[model samples]
Target: MFQTSSALIRNVHSQVADRVGTSIVRGDIGVGETLPSEMQICQMMDVSRTVVREAIRTLTGKGLVESRPKSGTRVRPPQQWNQLDPDVLRWRLETSDMDSYLAKLFQLRCAVEPAAAALAAISAGQDDLTLIRTAYEGMAAAKVNEKFVAADIAFHQAIYFATRNEFFWPIAQMFDVTLRQSFTIAARGSHRARALVEHNAVLEAIATRNAEGAREATNVLLKNSADDLVRIRGREFASRPKA
Candidate 1:
């Protein structure tokens, strides 16, 4: 039936959007390149014009592309893209030509998380302490199941919450997820043990009620993260992505 309903064709749009997104994110479609026309998309994906329209809508929301009456669709510059959206962040990180974005992520982590650790040391009460300790235990126990990465992230998030500031929470989760996912894909677990020791230092500082110590410990931890980024990306950036 020639129905106007979109539900039946929604998956087509989603698949179309994802394929284009992968291209953009992976730099198959470099910045400022005008995307193929709707008819071209129809040929490429074997979908109706309606599906192309909806797929473009999805890309627009992601800050990945823009459309004009004359220009059709153009890929936006990285500066114009959304960084806070997790998918956008992941796409940018995965497709980035330079390590600049990765460096920035570590820089932000270094700037904010250490201060949060200091705050957590001063602000946490018994309940907060329990949460923090549990997070720590999760990390320690992670080696048994090789889930240390998630446990490590939980430990940091708990510490962020213990600071009595809600804002640091998202940053904590975002950086943690991005970094852990990258490590999982990139074979970069080389520095995991160093991070664990650094984490322990932060927890011990909190247990001792030493705010500055907590700050320093977290600073060292983030520094380790930054160092790993530098080392890994240096090798990855040494060669250009295959044409």
Candidate 2:
């Protein structure tokens, strides 16, 4: 009974946080604006004060809100928010700013992935190479759209881990959400054969311990992806109704 009740409370807490976070991201609740009072929130949400308080804490931890002794809780500015937080990333993607978000995401990838790939080429052990090869094979064999994207993500993750740099792991894992979205967009107009060719180029470079080749291969892949997104975004914007 305790477990069930706890789960119910947690669900409500998450629901409240998600709604409020979405509102903040959408500008319904502007930064520096105080949220409803604890009592008012409890009443409006039809939950206890504890739930509202916990939800507020969750948002605070995500840098969405901050509490002050005299001012209550207020939404924080976008720059203050944790961009890597899963919930915050989801909120940003759900909003109309996905193009800008993707641009930033790709920029980040361009900054880190090529260097990581180069490191992997030099540092990967047999087991690490096996893992990367397995993921590459999965990508090569994936027949369905969803499977292909999942395999693509797995392939990149394997390379990140192969680098054997503890610091690289977390940074690479943080890209999970955005990477899926990116591959989805890329897959719309991308050919499976071309993707396999590019992926193979990177994998072969790493397997051969050619650091420069691995770096250049990853850079080329990212460049192609960015080009595809730019073309797609242009078409999408052109199709939108004039305001």
Question: Best by TM-score, which number?
Answer: 2
- lDDT score, candidate 2: 0.82
Give candidate 1's root-mean-square deviation (CA, Å): 6.5
Stretches of model 1 off by over 4 angstroms after superposition: 1-11, 97-104, 122-128, 163-166, 182-197, 204-210, 225-243
Task: Write model 1 residue lDDT over 1-243, tens digit each, in one string.
Answer: 011221224467877876787678777788999999999988877899999999999889989899999878999996787666666665665656445555555567777888998999998878888877887777767654347766666777788888888777777667564767544433355766666677789998987889999999887877666556557666643233233
Tell me how far the alpha carbon of residue 58 in candidate 2 is from the true structure, in angstroms, after superposition.
0.9
What C-alpha RMSD separates each model from the true structure?
A: 6.5, 5.4
For residue 142, give model 1's deviation from the true position in Å: 2.4
